[model samples]
Target: MKKAIKILFVEDEEALGMVVSDSLRSRGFEIDYHTDGESALQATLTNKYDILVLDVMLPKMDGFSLAREYRKVNRNTPIIFLTARSQTEDVVEGFELGGNDYLKKPFSMEELIVRVKSLIGRLLYSEESQLEECFVGNYKFNIQKQTLELNGKIKTLTYREAQVLLMLFEKRNQVLERKLVLDQLWGDDSFFNARSMDVFITRLRKYLRDDSNIQIVNIRGIGYKLLI
Candidate 1:
């Protein structure tokens, strides 16, 4: 049997959390649930999780702050934000902070399950053994090792960051849709996951900052383009 996808879920609503947790468990997901941002962040640091489902509004830390702190240490774990706030700015802010997908409150359990499956599928497909080393501008990326080397100096990449970069490299000069990216990485295309993808993109840009010839371009409503 395939390994279960590990998830860390941080939600303050106790009733909602139980329901979602139970639903996901029934579907064979390995889940860890928490009620506050601080404890969630701490648990994330110590545990190995494939994905994170976070709520924007939480006691003690809030989802955005928790994500920001998590990024400082773990730059690649995919995060999906679930919140009742539907404001455009709030949605934008969540992406800016590193959320991979977002789902508004009162969402259906079926939709959440579909999104999770999609994200996990993308991650699994992205790392298939058939894929070989790829070049991104001046640097060469060894996907298996999650390393990028330029001029003989090597830089290690977090697993999720490498996954995103590899996908962009595979579709270089083409529009990589936002939904496709989130679906592949976080298993859903919710608002929180969209924001999380943005954060990963920013980190990729920074990693390749020295190479002026390579660029990761945002195509507005579409997705991203890796210009080499």
Candidate 2:
């Protein structure tokens, strides 16, 4: 049998938390639920989980803050933000922070389950896995090794960096949405994760500085386009 997906669910609402937890458990997911951001953050730091479901408002630290802190230590675990705030700016902020997906209050459990399964599937098994190496601009990146080579010199990348670069390279010249990138790399697209991604992008820019023709341009609200 396939292993159950492990989830760290952080929500301040006790009733909703229990309901969601029980629902997910019934669907074969292994979930660890926390009612506050601090304990949730601690659990994430100490344990290994496949995904995170977070609430924006929480005691001690907000969901966005918790997600940011977690990114410092864990880079790839996917995060889904469940919030009652449904304004466009709020949604954008969530994406900016590095949240993979956002579900507003009164969301359907069935939709949540579907989104979780889809996100996990994409992260664990991407179409890019079919190719061993991808050429981005003038450099050749080995996906398995997570290294970028140009002119016989190889530069190793951090796990998150490699994942981001690989995704960009695969979708070169196309507009890669920020949320999609965040979801794929960090499991959530919230403000904190978005800032963390900016740092990673800066590092990547410096690494690819030698190639003048290649550029990774930010498309304002949309995402990034890897220009070759």
Candidate 3:
């Protein structure tokens, strides 16, 4: 039998916690749910978890502070922030502070499950076996090095940027769902991360601007298509 993935879920709402915990357990995951950031942080230090589902607003300690403390000692674990805030700055702040994803309020359990799976899939396995090099238009992408070479100029990309570029390259000429991308990279499709992703996409566009054949086209409500 496959080993159950362990998750440390931190949320203050009792009803929401019970529902999400039940749903995740039914999906073959082992969840250790906490009601506040303090307990959640304590759990992190003692128990090993594959991923962390954290609520931004928590009693005793906020999710952002908890994540920072957790990252100081264990940096590899993926963190997904759950919050009702949709502000772009807040989303950007989450990412800047080491959050891998963000989910806004009133989200469906199905969407939450999908985001969890996507984050685990990429962080734990898929990313490790990616191709060493990929071609995007006239650009030569070094996945391992996180650099792109075009017209003899090498441009280094941030970790997040590289992940976004790789996703676009894999789905070149195909529309990649915006929510999926956000979840896979940032943990949630909050308005803030959406805006942050747009910034990253723009940076990618600038890097690949020399090659007119390559374009990251936004698909309005759906997502983005990488034209190559």
Candidate 4:
């Protein structure tokens, strides 16, 4: 049997956290809930979680700072930012700090569950069984191990980054529409999400920079094409 999906959720509001935790537990997900960013960060560093759900405002540290620190040590774990602020700047900042998704306040438990489940489904189950290894120009990508090898150097990729790269590789030399990718990964193409996509595209470009022949070219107003 498959193991339960693990989640580390951080929220300052006691009532809300309890409700969300109870709801997720009812759905059979393993949860480690915290009320402050400092403790959350410590927990993340010591434990392995499939996904992170963090609130923006916390007692010791803010979500953005915690995410930045978390990425330094662990990039593979996916992160979702919870915030009452829906401003474009806040959303963009969250993504820039390596957030996978931004969820605004007053959200429905059902919506949050869907987002969490969707991320788990895509990040944990996508393409692991069928694709063992593939090539992107001169780089060897191992899907199961989630590593990129080139020139005797191996680098790890975050789950989202690997997913984006895989999608581009599958459509090599073909244009992948922006909205299609956004929907596939983020479940929506909102302005904030679109901006987040740009960040990931930039990251992919940097990752493939070693091979000049491999390029992810943007098709203005259309999408991106991976030219290999």
Best candidate per TM-score, number?
4
Among these predictions, the greatest lDDT belongs to 4
Residues 12-130 of candidate 2: C-alpha lDDT, one tens digit per residue: 88998999999999999999999999998888767899889999999999998998888667655667889888566666556445566778788899988977887788667854467
Which is superior by lDDT, 1 or 3?
3
TM-score of 3: 0.66
Q: Model 1, 21-83: lDDT tens per residue?
A: 999999899999999999998897689999889999999999999988987776556677898
Candidate 3 residue-wise lDDT, 156-227, digit = tens: 765577788889988889999999987667766776667899888888898899998888999999999999
TM-score per prediction, in order, is 0.67, 0.67, 0.66, 0.82
What is the model-wide C-alpha lDDT for candidate 3? 0.84
lDDT of 4 by residue, 131-223 (tens): 888999999998766689999999887666777888898899999988988998877988878887887899889988999998899999999
Model 2 quality (TM-score): 0.67
Ranking by TM-score: 4, 1, 2, 3
lDDT of each: 0.82, 0.81, 0.84, 0.86
Pairs that collide in candidate 3 are 100-186, 101-186, 101-187, 102-187, 102-188
